[model samples]
Target: MRIAMIMNGFPEISEKFLINQVSGLLEAGIDLDIYAAVRPSGSMRHFAAERYGMYDRTRYTRAARSTKTRVLDAPRLILSNFWSNPVAATRALSTKRYATAARNLKTLYFLEAFGKERYDIVHCHFGPNGLTGSFLKDSGIAKALIVTFHGSDINSYPSRHGTNVFRYLYERADLITANTSFTKGKLVANGCPEGKIAILPVGLRMEEYEFPKERVSRDEATLLTVGRLVEKKGHRYLMDALPSLRTRFSALRWRIIGDGPFMNVLRDHAKELGVSEIVSFEGTKNDQDVAAAYMSSTVFVLPSVTATDGDMEGQGLVIQEAQASRLPVVSTLHNGIPDGLLDGRSGILVPEKDSPALADAIGRLLSDKDLRETYGNAGRDFVAETYDIPLLTKRTVDLYESCITS
Candidate 1:
C-alpha cells in the first residue's frame, strides 16, 4: 500500500525512530513517501537517510517564515508550481485554508508541495501534525489519517494551547496511536474516543545491542543516563541524590549523555552539591558512542519527572535502548515509564522527584551484582520479545492493513 509519512522534520538526530520505521516499512515491501512540514535544522543527518535514498522520496516545506520572506516567496512558490500541478494550485488557492495560506506563506508552501502526492494513508508521527494530515485527507490527498502522540504532544502541548486544542484533530483523524498506556489514558481523559486509541511504542533494533553479560567490573561504579539535559529528565533530582550517595559510596562516577538548555543549571547544581568531580556531562553522543557508554556502564538511570510545563515522559525510549545492552535501568514511576520498564525486573522504579528513593534504588543495584545481571537479562529478553523493531513493524503492518480495508 502507498503511504505518506508526515513529520515535523526528516532525518532528525533525536527522532531517528521515524527514519527507522520508514526503513523497516520499505524493507517490508511497502510503498512509502515522506512529507515534512519543516526543513531540517541540523547538519547531523542520520546515515539511513542516504542509505535508504529517502531524500529522493521526501518533500519538505519550511514550517514558518518571516513576513518579508513569505511575501516575496509566496508569489514565486505559487507561480513556479502552477504549470506542474495547475489544478492543485488553483484548488488550494480557492479553498478556505487558502486564507491561512494568504497569511502564512508556509501554510501555502506545504499545501503547494504536498498537493502533488496521492496516498492511501497519511501517518503523522506527532499529535500536532494531525491537523496537516487531516487537511490532506479532507482535501482528498489521502484516504485516511492516523496520528501518533509521543510525549509533549499530549502533556505540555495541551497546557500551552489549552486542553481542547486537539479537538479538531481528534474529530478529523481516522486512528490514533499512543506510545504508552499512560499516554492513551491521557488522550481519552482529554476526550478522544477510547476505542480509536492503540498502544504502539517506539521500538528498538535488539540484535544491534548484543546484551552485555555484565557491567564492567571495576574499582569505581560507573553510572550512565542518556537523555536531553532538561527538567523533565530529572537531572536536578539526580544531582540531589548524588550528594547523599557520595556519603556511602566513595568511588562513584556518573556520565550524562545529551545536552540542552538546562546544561548550565545542571552543571551549577552538580557543583553546588559538591559532586561535580564525580559527574561527567558528556554532551550528545552518536550511536556508537552511546552504545559504548551503555557497554561500559554499571547501571542505566532515567530519572524522569513531569516537567514544569506539564510535559511528561512518553515511555522512555532510552530505557529499552539501555535494556537492549543488558544494562539494568533505574527510573521514576513517572507517566508512561512504568509501561516500558518492568519494576524490579528490568530495573527499579522510584517515586517521582524523590531523591532519596532514587539514590536508594541506584544503591541497591550497585551493591548487588547478581541482581543487576538478572534484571539486565530480563530486560533484554523483554525487548526481544516485545519491543524489537522487526516484531513491532509487523504489528504496524497489520494496523496499516486495517486502516486501508476499513
Candidate 2:
C-alpha cells in the first residue's frame, strides 16, 4: 500500500511522534511518502528526508517567507499567509481574514504537489491543516483521506471558524482518529459520526523511553511539566499554585521543560510570587533529557485549561510519556486528559484552571509514598497496554488497510 502523510512541518523536535508513525508504517511494509508545506533546509532537510524516506514537496518553490522577509512584512505577511486559499485563491480574496488566504495557499500548494503522486491513502495530522487533504479527497485526488485530530486543532480551530469543514472532513474521511476517548467524545458532540471515530492514543517508542535503573534522585521533591510554554498549558496556574504549595512543602522544586512565547510571562509571574529560587525553567530539553527529567521527578503535572481564545488540551501526550517513565501524573479534567489518566487508577485528575486542586493533587502524591508507587506502576502498565508504538502501529495499519480495501 502507498500512504501519503501530511503535516505542517517535517522533522520538528516537538513532533517526533509523526516521524515515528511514518517510520512505523514503512517498517510494516507499506510504502510511505511524507508531504509537508514547509521543511527545514540544508543538512537537516536532507537528514530528515533520508531518515524518514520523505518526499520533498516543499522544494517545489521557494515562495515561502524567510525569517528576514517575515520580519520586514510581519503584518502584511501574516494577513496574506492567513487568507490565501490554494483551492479557491481568487475566491478567498473576498474574505476578511488572512487565515483564509493562508489556507487557500496551502490548498493550492497541495493541489500542485500531489497532482502526480499515486497514493492509496492521504492521512493528515491535524484539523485545519487537514483541510488540504480533505479538499483533495473531496476533489477525487486521493483514493481515501483520513485525519488524526491532535488536540488543539479540534479544540480551537474548528470551533473558531464555525464552518462545517471539520464535520465535512469527518463525514467524508475514510476514518477519523483521536488520541483519547475525551477527544473522540468532543468530536461526536461537535457532530462527527461516532462510528467513524477511532480512539488511538499517540504511541511512544517504549524502548527509547525506558526508565533508567541508575537514575539519580534529586534531594528536593521535584514536580515537572513538559510541553510548549503556552497559555493553554496552564503554566501560569501551576506557578500560582507554587506559593501555596511552598508554604506547606518547603522542600518542593518545580521544573518546567520546553520554551515558547509565554516563558517571559511565566518568569515574571514566578518572581512576583517569590518562588523564583524553587522554579527551574529548563528550556526545551531533548527527548532523552526529557525522559531523564521524568525519571528524576517525584511527580509530573499538566494543569492545562481552555484558554480565552478557546485553545485547549486535546490529549496531553506528556502525561503518558511521564507515566511511561513510571512517574505519577498530576493533571486536570481538561479536554482528553481524563481519558488518558484513568483518574483514580493511573493518576489524579483535578478540575481545570484550579490551582488549589492542582496543588492538592501534587501534595497528595508527595505525601503518600505507597499511593505514588502504586499509581506510577499502574501508569506504566497502562501505557504499555495502550500507547506502546508496536501495538499502536498495528492498529493504525489495520485502519489504513480497511480504508484502502474499502
Candidate 3:
C-alpha cells in the first residue's frame, strides 16, 4: 500500500525510533512517502536514513515565513499550482476550516499532494503533524488518517491550548495510536473516543542490540543516561544523587549522552553539587555510538519527571534500548516509563525527583553483581519479547489495512 508518513522534521539524530519504524516499513515492502514540515538543520543523522534513501523519499516544505510575507505570496502560490490541480488549489484557500493556517499559506503545501496520485493512508508521527494529516484526509489527499501520540503532544500541548484543541482532528482521524497506556489515557482525557485509540508502544530493532551474556565487569560505578538534556529527563536528580553515592563507592562516574538547551544548566548543577568531575556530559551520538555506550555501561539511569508545562515522558524509547542491550535500568515512576521496563525485574523504579531513592536503586545494582546480572538478562528477554520492531511493525501494517477496509 502507498502511505504518506507525516512528520515535523525528517532524519533527526535523537529520534532513532522514527528511523527504526521507517526502516521496518520499507523492509515490509510498503510504498512509503515522507512529508516533512521542515528539513532537519544538523549534519548528523542516522546511517539508516542514507541506507534507506529516506531523504529522497521526503517532500520538505519551505520553513515558516512571516504572516505578511505569506499573505503577499498567497496569490502566486495559488496561480503557480492552479493549472495543475485547480480543485485542490481552490480548496487550499478555504478559510472556514483552516482559518489562520490557510491565510498563513500553510495549507498550500498540502495542495502539492494533488501533483501526484492520492495516498492510500497518511500516518502522522505526532499530534501537531496529525492535525496536518487530518487536513489531508479532509481535503481528499488521502483515504485514511492515522495519528500517533508520543509524549508532549498529549501531556503538555493541551495544557497550553484547551482539551478541545484536538476535537476536530480526533473526529477526522481514521485511527489513533498511543505509544503507551499512559499516553492512551491522556488521549481519552482530551476527548478522543476510547474505541478509536490503540495502545502501540514505540518498538526497538532487537537484532541490532547484542544482548550481553554477563554484566560488564567494572571497578568504577558507571551510570549511563541516554536522552536529550531536558527538564523532564531529570538529569539534575542524577547530580543530586552523586554526593550520597560518593560516600558508598570510591570510583563513581555518570555519563550523559545526547544534548539540548539544558546542557549548561546540568553542568552548573553538577558543579554546585561538587560532582562535576564525576559527571561527564557527552553530547549527541549516532545509533552505533549509543549502542556502544549501552554495552559498556554498568547501570542505566533515567530519572524522568513531569515538566513545568505538564509534559511527561512517553514510553521511554531509550529505556527499551538499554534493556535490549542487557543493561539494568533505574528510572522514575513518571508517565509511561514503567511500561517500558519491568520494575524490580528488568530494572528499578523510584518516585520522581527522589535522589536518595535514585541513588539507592543505582547503589543496589552496583553493590550486588549477581542482582545486576539477573536484571540484565531479564531486561534483554523482556525487550525482545515485548518491544521487538518486526512484530510491532506488522501490527502497525495490520492497523493501516484495517483503517482502509473500515
Best prediction by TM-score: 3
Tell me the whole-model lDDT of each prediction, alpha carbons only. Answer: 0.81, 0.75, 0.84
Question: Candidate 3 has what TM-score?
Answer: 0.93
Which scores better on TM-score, 1 or 2? Answer: 1
Q: List, residue by residue over 1-406, the lDDT tens digit for candidate 2.
A: 8788887766666776776676677778877777776764323233333565555422332226454643454455334434643444343333233244234456555555565566788898887666666666655667898989987777777667774547556766888998878778778888889998898888777776675577547335799999989888999988889988888887899998888999899999989999999999988666667878887889899999889998888777788888888888989888878877768877998888898888888888888878887998899889888888889899999999989888
- Which lDDT value does model 3 have at 275? 90
Instruction: List residue ranges in candidate 1 displaced over 4 A.
Output: 64-107, 211-220
Leading candidate by lDDT: 3
Q: What overall lDDT, based on C-alpha atoms, would model 2 receive against the true structure?
A: 0.75
Model 3 per-residue lDDT tens digits across residues 201-282: 8888987788445744444588999999999999888789899999998888899998999999989888888999988889
Better of 2 and 3 by TM-score: 3
Q: Give the 10-residue window scoring lowest on summed lDDT in candidate 1.
A: 94-103
Superpose all Cα atoms of candidate 1 onto the true structure and report the RMSD in Å to 1 decimal: 3.0
lDDT of 2 at 362: 85
lDDT of 3 at 171: 88
**Number of residue pairs clashing in candidate 2, backbone atoms closer than 3 angstroms, sequence gap of 3 or more or interchain:** 19
Quote the lDDT for 297 in model 1. Answer: 88
Count of steric clashes across candidates, in order? 0, 19, 0
lDDT of 2 at 2: 79
